[model samples]
Target chain A: MKKILTIAALALSFMFLTACDSMDSPSPLDTRASDTSGELNPDGLPGDATMGADSGLQDRGLNSINGFDPENINPEDIVYTIYFGFDQYAVGSSERDKVKSAADFFAQNPDMKIVLVGHTDWYGTEEYNMLLSDKRCRAVSDYMGNIGTDPSRIEIIARGEAGATMDVAKNSPEAKKDRRVDIVKVK
Target chain B: MIRRVFLGLFAGIICTSALFAEDAGTIRKDAGRLNVPIYRVAITSSDADTANLAKRAFGTHGSFRLSAPSQAQFIFDFAPSGGNSVKLTIKGGTVYEQVFSGSNSVEALMKACDAAVMKTIRTPGYFAGKIVFSYSKNGGQTSEICTSDMVFRNVRALTRDGNDSLMPHFSPDGSKIIYTGYYRTGFMDLLLIDLNTNTRKVFAAYKGSNTGGSFSPDGTRVATILTSTGNAEVWTASANGGGFKRITNTSATESTPSFSPDGRTLIFAGDYRGAPQIYTAPATGGKPSVVRTNISGYCSEPVWNKVNPDLIAFTIAQGKGFQIAVYNFRTKQTKVVSRGASTSGPKWLNDGRHIICTKSNGANRQLYIIDTETDSQKPLHTTSFGSAKEPDFAYTAR
Candidate 1:
């Protein structure tokens, strides 16, 4: 009776050791399978049949994992639409919201990189517009940093007054559309 | 009738006093020293005839008379005729005379009239060692280059039929003239004209508006502003037009380029800084740096003083008027050369002591020479009725 009791204790400790070892592996799905299989097989391990059945159950369970659902996967690419005030690059309340959205997306996906492209209307001089474009890009980048986005993940570029979308007409809605920052996701 | 007569008498007294009193001092002094008497005369005619008709009625004397019909006239005797026939001659629309023996009544009168008109038109100290400039007149609506004396006299129209001919720069040797002209195609190209031969040949058929043609210090190449890529930029090509190299990029509007005294630096006005300001770059083409800043006004048309490399003169607008100011590279300060009103097109004389600039009096514009040492300015020529501007001092023509 004593020998049988000691053997049973040893068997139970072995099962626990295997469970802990699976938990330390890179994938947590393997340990989740062992939790469902209660029996120790003749090979001194969970039976292959039971492991296979558990894997099937794990596959079904994977779909319900929080934040891991395929349908809930955030896109690797992000588009940040920045609207500028009339003849200004100062980040206003509305533009700050756009920047915060971009930052949040970046925070959720830390592996992604962003390019902050600045554009301007055709109303001002080319030289001044070029500088303003640079300022706009920098402003967006700064806002992203304020909201927990890595500074290294952002790059700034300027298009100046060239490539204007507003047909050279200032104070128009189309011109205001031209003066904006296009945050594109690279990789 | 009585009131009219009294008013005429009062006007006669005022006119007589003004003419006799103010005129007597200078006229008598000059005449007495020259041993001559000054005279005033007028020719009367009937109501039925015109002034020319009345003069014709006087016969041969009409042409020679010092006084013409229905016109007030004055004359002064210079010297007794020294057997040189008192003949009236007109050249370039100016009248002159030479005295001779056996003078007819008409001949004597002609000689005296010629002497008086010559005295009034002739300025002794004017246009001496001065350079002239040719500008498109008639508000730039026509392609005519009008010449003005450095002080702005003798404004003769140089070219009448050549439309859009501009940037007339003298060659280094001063024997040839180079300019850009549009020939029917509406594209300005470089042209060289031999001043001695009056022969012209197209120097460069640049693709776009080739203007602001300037001769290199050695006269081997012509540096000009070419708008080849739909944007104006500085370029250098062979003076006879073969090799072309763009000196500036398409990112800016770079025009009005002036070479430094050493020809190693090119100074130009560009929109690189969001406004038209002076910038200097390597003559071989490189990054350009700002030369004039701090003043938030438009600064254009830079001319380097050949003798004083440290000095550069350009026009800057203050309020509603533009003034000519010189920037000293060493001193790092600007001095205004023009006083009130507007000034433009400041060109330095070879001596560097004076600058010829266009001065406008709100109503009319003319050329004025500003002395750097004395800070004094004087009108170059006072006879032109039409507006005159853009005085470019000729360096090689000396």
Candidate 2:
């Protein structure tokens, strides 16, 4: 009985110490090197590399990068989607690369245009979904403009929960597939 | 005290056993509350096709019942007139006769028979009208707007945009259909299709979102929810998609704005207080008041009764499923009219007693007409169409 009591007291002390440790310092934010892959962060915000003092993509215009031949570039190969977090409209690190690519393509082919279709999952109010989708398009448009894509070349359409990527349950990881900006190429 | 306790226990047993009865209270006790005459109809025809078509049209009528000719108050008689036409006569205490033409096929004949039934009964007819709803294929990856007659015949595809097209609503006069269609450009634009002209145009493709377009009673303005102002708000603009103005501005998301019969007010679904509830505001735009009748859970997709202004039909979400419910203004009581199945998107027909709603079990969703007066439901039989939803009833054939 004495031994059992001693073990119980030690276990309680250890749990208390662990709880104090957790309360003393909360989990730090993500601090890894920013991903350079052309994709969006699940959190729908810019990565650490894109937020630093002077190395942000906003400072680098399309003219700074080597332009590509838009005519030779197959739309199926160059086309990519930029996903947003739930109810969010911010451009993340990965999506920034795709926007830069689109800007570069348009720079080489001035006559071409890129259409950004905004969509949302079947989760919120239909009206709110429309607005959410439009916000996503606006976020992409602003990013394109920041990178030197002509405003005339960027056309936005907001489809409110009409074109959902995943028809599964709402707010699930699969449903997030629907809340994205589908980038299509236009001549 | 012992004797009283025994009696109370015995009475509780009897009440609990009564709950086991099936189809109890299916037929409403106060049928006269609808103020529409109930007629028993008997159909007879020399042609097998005509007889079948007539039965299908009046089988689930809200104000009519199928009965034997001897007991029926009215009898419908059909005879083949010539190549693809029939003459119909309805005999009650008085005799009424008419010749219907261009009914070569079952589809055409059913429509003519439905029109004849309504004309004979002297009620505003909906049997010959059309319904526009959304249909999805490839596991809902792609959707299109489709319209069919009341019996789900003569279906026609309105938009072949190859993107996603849905939420087709007929105009007040049934001359046009307003819906949202996704273009290749990746955004949804409100498109209006003129049925009379076979022409379509983009109604509102605003910077943000232009959707939920509903016409006012006067047909001069359209009440819609737009995000051009950075938040979802109800707005009214010209029927031609000009003269745009904002109506509601709460931080909460507003959607599915339904104009009342008077066009003076609009009822919409919103999460005004953290949970979805129905709220009403002026059609011209102003502060909204919550419509808290008897519903306590989330309610959305509200539609006002066109003929009767006293009742509102909406879909209420309850524990993993939705049910069609109607709220009575006079009694302030909400009654669940659909039973044993999940339902959504209830729209009242012109009769004000029948409603078109989607009955689904998550796997297959089909449109079913629910007669609120009798608590009976009949599926809208669209041939070979696996799934259909979001039914909007039109009173006239435009």
Candidate 3:
């Protein structure tokens, strides 16, 4: 009787051991890392982390801005309002003071170049808007040249009325502010 | 005796299980490279699985197999099948029937299938050619002078220093190209560039816009649209840019000039009748004559075929889109080459079998070569996502 009981016990232990072995074995799918970011991460786990440590990886692998973060930009670069009258590209008295301040900043930094991007309100066809925008840009470029700035250092771009005139009414203050030039410094 | 019987039963059970396990494993074909599912079915005389059927349904089309209980799976290795849609019927663990259906004709389908199997078939060698044109890359708004492929591949910015380059004309031999580049100092000059050598030379430094250049058949003189006296007109000069003479006196915008096969007459796009139309004039000085009439909606860019000068192809804005229409000077009848909603910039190949034109999907433009005989069109290049405008074909460079 003891012999029979021993045999049965051995068989049961064998079956249990086989089941445990099967459960402990790693799956083939688990060998590959999860693609949660939807990007083809060729180097796989720990290698990717080390390579991307210097720069935080953007969603599309774009390099993150080092020091000049858009969120942490200085308040001086943001000009809230610039007013222009109908069919006019000349700087008014109030806007001239602002432009002078911009010019002073550009003059202090000799190596810096300025980009004058002109815009117009939605009052004409696309072709005419492009022409008007050119006129406005030329006016700003001429103004900078008269103020003793190098003509080659100043770049002019015309944006036309494509991005001007928000969903608000034309009589609104924001609408008037949209018809103007944006000055940006380029290094 | 009972112990021996138990031992025998255990051994028998293990052997049977081992056999079943071997049968359950996937059977591999092609030197164990391709693993296929094992199927079992009874085969009768009426439901016989022929080798051809096996080759057609699974092996030739894609990887498939047939097997019976305790037998190795049978694999058929046949030529690759063609066509987009395929139908197959399996009977008794084998493919008994097959049918193919697709947009391609039978001959084309067979050819495609043969190509897929051999992997050596290619489109005609000449189909991968390109045409160079002057385009505005930068410098103010209209500082044109750039070269692009027929389908706008590898768009290289040739001149970007704010000079206005216009009316690019290829040399007769197609080894060199000529154009008028206007400088900021108001000096209009004729610039010539050897395509192979990449050597540039300023031939003529004339006053006003020295535009609308065309190469003569014998490659001796270049017919150009010059506005010397404040009026746009046709002029000719030696290929080396000497002995310049005015050919016409028109206050209208006389631009886009081309030469006849014999280089005796010139066809240009102008607006003498209020709207832009095609007009022909003598290669020497003379009055212009209207070529086509009745139906008109801004027709321009008249390019004469090298083989047949009587057949002139130009672009016309018809319906909601622009189309390339050919005008037979003999019949005075116009026929549309491209059926797309937007097409322009018609240029003829040296053989005159096809004309390359710019086709647009309203948002982006691509280069398409249309066969003149059949009126069938195909994309020239496979890449590029921007607008490719103004194509001018030159002869295959020697």
Candidate 4:
């Protein structure tokens, strides 16, 4: 009877340990220090919120003045468009989740390649918009790299107003839909 | 389209019959509403179809007016060939009487008219010139390069790659065209095409981006933008793509570099000061200076007038859109050339008084030629392609 009791105790202990391991395993994106509060850095980059004084995200290659989250993104999602502010390449606090989600998707699909096509509205010059779109794509690429996506699997394209999702004039609310980076999966 | 026809009909019935009919005996120098020089030409064709084609071709032109064959200063006669060809002859008060043969009767008649005007006015004729522009196809995913006459007739594709090709610029001598192509998707390819041979080659296909190519007036070099070294900077290269020299070194983007008539200076658009503005620099590369213009908003795509060196036309951001504007160096005045709608890509015609630009209504984009002196803009009639933009003019002798 004692032997059977010991065997049951061992089984219970193994089950508890397995559950703990499952909970303790770090996310593929967790290699970089994260904000436990799920709050994004106001600087449009990602890192520990407590270390805001330091340019934590800047050192990680993020150049945006605002932040976005790409967490909890599914790789199978057909398309994801992240919009930007007026004449701004900064992914703001409200948009950080998209970045985190993109990072999560990239992490989940190791062999997948993504083309981040950046676009702008018809407000600025074509040359200026081209550069602005490029800067936006760089910001996204930096965040993806920060969260453990292989840089080689990512491509950035500055489409300017060429890939505009909305056909609206400048200064209109609908025009804001054009200023975006479309994350398209190629693999 | 209705407005254009109404204006034409109004001028045809009211001005031609009422105002100018009484003054037909005297040479009406300023008969049209625009108050420009008037040249009356009588057009005659061997067939009624050819005669109707000639009338339609010349109706939209802002230059000559029609008159009775006996009282006309110039006479244009068209002889049709067995096929789609026509032999055009122009003779009258000018020392020019020539017979030119071409495939299309309409195009042949227009060329004959242009030649006649050039003989009388002693100015460079734009009617016989061709324009190379970018047209969006396959739902804007790809763009094809096309060439058309100034009247936007007889359009032929220069590229069938169905890729995103933009910013077509004519070489100084009109023998070649240089453009930026996206045949490789995310990569840019600077392509050069020989108009005579219809052959294309990669002029500068760098890794990052290659765009904004403009040939120098001397045709010895080309100024363009390359991002091979981090950021987009203005760079000049040999006409044959042999030697390359970087022109601007800025963290910001520099683009659309055009050379002055003397080939000593270059005017380009840059955002070094945060907002895009026109800036001038020496062709040999040196410290750049801001263009002294009265425009307060974003300015870009500044092209130096080939005939009038003192005038520089550019695109300025306007109310909910963009418009074409000209900055006069001699008067230090800035005048808006385009009106009512959004216009971009202001490229100067050889006439120095007119410019070709892209005008959009947030849905459709088309090419329009604006006369700066009159502030009059007319849409170019191109083949029913998707959206046509970025037109470059090349003068071809007929």
TM-score winner: 4
Candidate 3, clashing residue pairs? Answer: B135-B146
Candidate 1 lDDT over residue span B112-224, tens digit each: 43343324322111122224344433343333344333322123344444344454676666656666554333334555655565445556543334466677777777777
Worst 10 residues of 2 chain B by lDDT: B18-27
Total clashes for model 2: 6
lDDT of 3 by residue, B1-398 (tens): 99999987887675444333334334445331224323232112121222222222112111123344245332112222444333323222223334434343222222222222212111122322346654431112343444543323234444443444544667876776786654332234456656575545555543233455678888888877654343456677777655666777775656677789998898887766655688889988799998863455577778888787778888775775568888887777777767864777788875465677766553344557776554557664332323344566664421
Where does the lowest 10-residue lDDT sum fall in candidate 1 chain B? B54-63
Best by DockQ: 2
lDDT of each: 0.54, 0.66, 0.52, 0.67
> 2 or 4, which is superior by DockQ?
2
Q: List the residue pairs that clash in candidate 1.
A: B83-B100, B84-B99, B84-B100, B85-B100, B86-B100, B149-B152, B151-B380, B151-B381, B152-B380, B152-B381
Instruction: Give me the TM-scores of chain B across the candidates.
Output: 0.63, 0.84, 0.61, 0.81
Q: TM-scores of the first chain across all predictions?
A: 0.56, 0.55, 0.54, 0.55
| DockQ-based CAPRI category assigned to the predicted complex of candidate 1 | incorrect
- Please, what are the lDDT tens digits per residue for candidate 3 over residues A1-187? 9999999999999877653342222211122325333222212212111111111111111122222222222546543234677546667777877677777778898887565656677543222333345456556666767887787675544455534543344557665766887776655
Tell me the TM-score of model 1: 0.46
Candidate 4 DockQ category?
A: incorrect
Q: Write the per-residue lDDT of candidate 2 for residues A79-136, one digit (tens) a residue.
A: 6789887666788886788878877877888866676777787654345566667778
Candidate 1 wrong stretches, greater than 4 Å: A1-187, B1-132, B135-140, B148-156, B361-364, B395-398
